[model samples]
Target: MIEDMLRTPAAVQDAERHTAHNYHPLPVVISSAEGAWVTDVDGRRYLDCLAGYSALNFGHRHPALIAAAHAQLDKLTLTSRAFIHDQFADFCRALAALCGKELVLPMNTGAEAVETGIKVARKWGYQVKGVPAGQATIVVAEGNFHGRTTTIVSFSTDDDARADFGPYTPGFKIVPYGDLTALAEAVDETTVAVLLEPIQGEQGVVVPPAGYLPGVRQLCTERNVLFIADEIQSGLGRTGATFACELEGVVPDMYLLGKALGGGIVPVSAVAADADVLGVLRPGQHGSTFGGNPLACAVATEVVRLLATGEFQRRSTELGERLHAGLHALIGKGLVAVRGRGLWAGLDIDPALMSGREACERLMERGVLAKDTHGSTIRLAPPLTITAEEIDHAVAQLAAVLAG
Candidate 1:
């Protein structure tokens, strides 16, 4: 069994040698997955802590979601936006109801949903809010991880992600994350929206300061600017809630959702808002060929259902306490600190003890799997369906690694 894994498969090697080195994944090539674990090409199993950046909130190949996708595929897969399909309205209505919003604009990926949100905010700024065209600005937090679009990265403060990516896209202003003062001062007459993540996941799961979210929401309302929460990485029971904003009892004018919306089967994402905010887009302004396709719509409809039940959210909340407590036990030893919500937590490590990548490598060797973010932080975002025993076991492995 060990020998089989020692032999790198041809497919993995070829892709490594030829593909762009955008990501440095751990050295396990997964062949199948179920629940909270994944089997590698050599049939070795590991508890999945990353969970595709919270994309598998319902876990791998959830039976209900798969059934929906299969049932839809048997009927119709793609009708495109040229015409609607049977599943489209059901999915839209379901998601809209879940979001408690009047409208939904389905898309295929987090980036596209974010892009759609930006467009929607801008159009509303012009058509409704009466902002000047092309002069509209969106205030984004400094450490935000909205998506990897040219425009998204254009405003990024991370040198690695922003350097040489431009000239850069304009019409965006950046302020220090978690700083309400900066956000308050950044707004002007031309500001259309304040686009931000509830938790800065890509920035190593940085949680905002207390009262920050409610304050931002208030600011947007008072300033007549839309509040766009990019919950793509932090939503849908991943943060132990239907949406991360619930922790603060705040609601934004628009929500950007993705990752878990596909139930880990497909890439389905969407933006939700009231008609007054998102109604600016007419029939021809924007769309995608695969957006709201029958297959994705069907799959996403089930995904919303799973999240609606309080089960996933309750599990995440209960497990999150254990996960964080277990991780907190390691702080000031080998770990620097632990910060996150729900099933996702980013642990910062002592620089001299071990880098986050080294810790991840060690964890991988020890039969658990997780990934590093930024430089010295490892993000653990297991599925909400993960068992308590699995969390304890993974924590034990991490404890052993720290002890060493």
Candidate 2:
């Protein structure tokens, strides 16, 4: 049994043989998962704390999402933007109502949603705001992780995601995150929008100052600029609220949503905004082949229905307190700091003890799976379905790992 546990499965070896070497995954090759736990090929059960970077927020193969997908599969799948599918209107209406927005443009990935937001903002500037055709600019914060598209990476501050990927796209200005003065100074006549994440998940789940989001909302309103909140990773109840911006009573002009929208079944993303802001685009101006496909819409509509109940958000809030409390108690023992909201947390381990990668490997060995971001920081985002006992078990494993 010990020898089998130490052996790397042939599946793990074959997986990386043909694929792009983009990701450095942990050693475990999972074969099955249910709720908060996944079983590797070796039959080892590990509590999943990463939750597919929050894409599995509803947990793996949730019954409702699965049933939706199964039902849609039997009826129809992709009709594309060329023809409307039966599931389209219901999804668009449900998601738009959830966002309190008049219109929604669905896409297949977070990157597509962000790209859609940028295009909409630029067109709105050119047509409505009367900015010059080629001169409209958008302001983005430093340390943002929007996506890896060529145009998106143009303004990225991360060297790894941005390096050698340019001749970059232009018309974006960078501002110090959470600094109202810096953000205000960065916005000018050419600025059409300010794109930001309410909580920077990839940047170790960084949350800004209390009033910063409201200040941005006000600044955008005053300057006639669109405030585009990139809530791909931070939204959908991961932050204890429907949207993290709701935590501070701030509402953005547009919302770029994805990640958990498909409920771990398929890729679903959307840009939500009022008709006035999203109205700038004509039919042929922009679209996607598989955006709002029947299967995606069906599954995502159920995801919206689940969120409508507020059960997941409530779970995140109550369970988050327990999770954070357990993490906070470990500070100064081996942890340097902890930051995040809801069931999401970013832990800064003592660099003197181990690198974040080493820490994650140790945790995996102890049956808890997590992902590390930068130098000594690791992120914890378990499914909202996780229970108090599960949260306690995860925290205890971390404490044991730290103690050793």
Candidate 3:
């Protein structure tokens, strides 16, 4: 307690003083982390349940990713889009194969991948789909947590992410998530693409109805529109599969990937699509300076390799069943509901007992780290590296917190 009072407060204050106050992070200041545990500055260790919002799906500084990064650092780090880099082609090939797509467009962040998808879809609409110029429309699901760029936020329904950010961009139609009828009504002749997160991670790890994704795919194909799945958080073995859409046997026209793509080491994102769709981009139309830099490609290449082995996916499937069983057992105790799949979960605390923020704060005090999304819903997305014993420990901590 003395160490926390003496050293931690100063460090926390210094951090708050220097940074923009956009994020409301928990009070603990983490200094180091390993597989599924992080040590705060005051020498207290906590089980990390959030896993950087699924960015650290492979856990902190995974050996393969670190080795790849270290080896590449010695050889090459950055070679902008101006010149061809050795690491670029391999990453693109590997990721494209993983997504069963013909081409891959590299980007630096999730938002960039999304923006790239939008541009490609619009271009494809005009050139290939024969849609009228400047009339391209993209249908998006409400409660999506796409990256907060000006254009991406334009179609957002979340007031917190949308308000005061205007004047907003247009060319998008919003539909209720998991409602095939609403989505169908939103799409028309001008619709070029339908973008959605297979499992809405930020909106409380909300999984849509069983047939909703398959229905979206059928509709997109029948309507001659591209279906884009934003798998930044729900992909790469997070949902007990390589991609959450695969859980429903749905393959989209494009995959917007990021977060774990960098192996949690660097910012890496990409858009995977067939040749005719991504080929719409000309040389100078869309590019990023550091999009497929050698370092990012080197690390992300290994990430693709790791997923190819299917070990993490297996772990997610088996451990996810256990995690869900544990959570489902606690439904009426303090949790009103539990939703999600694989290593990801969203627990809704009984609001009469406490808000999600308060429960997470209590979990923090009990040496477990989680995050709240809205109201009484808190999301848990532990790394796939977590063991069954660790899963039990985390569940036990939640039970104790609820009991108190």
Candidate 4:
């Protein structure tokens, strides 16, 4: 017991000493993980509820993904964008088919995908829409979390992300989220696109009001502005649907995808769009050196194949209903509200009982791991592989934490 107790704190201290203070993670020092569970340095296991902020939506080291990565390691890895690799065409074709789009521009991270989308939208505005140069603007929502890039963080509503990150990039207009009127008013002649998350994942998994997404689609269509859906955190079966926009029967002009696309193995992200919108780029217009490499493509191709089977999506849908029901039952007891779709949820615990951080720390003690957002709100996004009994166990642990 003494050895175990000393090991974790020493490991944690060593980690803290070397890293930047960008994150305040839980005290638990994880040594290894599998689907929906992780083992700490002390060999104690904990249910993984956050799923690497939805990056591990397929769970840790999925068999198919791991196999693909292992096979590719022995073969070619990178060819840059200069020369086409053999694995490129198949991965792009499969992902484009999954998105129902004509073209896919692969990147290495979600932020890169978002940046690519923004650049494409601006180019489309100048070439196709004949917008005045330097006047092209994009409309975004408040409380949105796109990425931490300088341009992205420039328009961020969060002070922690935006503050001290200047001189900020201009040309973005922010409006209240879920308010169609405000969004419509924000767009004008210079507006080139409407960038939004159908379901704001980082914002406590906040699902916009029903019909809000379709409304935005209509507004963008009527205004002749591109609609870019940042599905980095909410897509790839995280919300039961292939894309959260599908839940509303709406389709955006461009889809920014990441996270689960790598299947928890490597960094992979892409932008999917129809030919006309994405074809605006000429040779040398935009590219990534490591984007669409052989290894990334191989693993991502398997990831696409996994999604094609539809098992994960089905699991998310069926399991989500059960999870939401359990969360709803706790509303009066300790939770003030619960918001999300599919397996994703943001639980607002009663502040009178404890802050979200305290609740998560308590949950960590109980063998379940979760993350907190705005002060009193905790987000739960377990892998689709989680079983019903595991869901019940997590909920019961939360109840016990609240009671204490």
> What would the per-residue lDDT of candidate 1 be over residues 1-404, giving only the tens digit for each residue?
76664544665787698888887887788889999899887777899898899999888888898899889888999988999788889999999999999999999999999999989989998999899878999999888787888998998888878788788888999999988998999999999999999999988988898899999999999999999999999999888888999999999999999999988988999999999988888999999999988889989999888878889999999999999999999888799889998888999988788889999989988889998877788899998889999999999999998888
Per-prediction TM-score, please? 0.98, 0.98, 0.99, 0.98
Q: Cα lDDT of model 2 overall?
A: 0.95
The global Cα lDDT (0 to 1) of model 3 is 0.94
Worst 10 residues of 3 by lDDT: 1-10
User: Which pairs clash inside model 1?
Assistant: none
lDDT for each residue of candidate 3 in 83-164, tens digit (9 for 90 to 100): 9999989999999999999999999899899999899999999999999999999999899889899999999989989999
Q: Residue 104 error for model 1, in Å?
A: 0.3
Q: Report lDDT (CA) for all predictions.
A: 0.90, 0.95, 0.94, 0.94
Worst 10 residues of 1 by lDDT: 2-11
- Cα lDDT, model 3, residue 306: 99
Name every residue pair that clashes in candidate 2.
Answer: none
lDDT of 1: 0.90
In model 4, where do residues sit more than 4 Å from their true spots? Answer: 1-5
Report residue 78 deviation for candidate 4 (angstroms).
Answer: 1.4
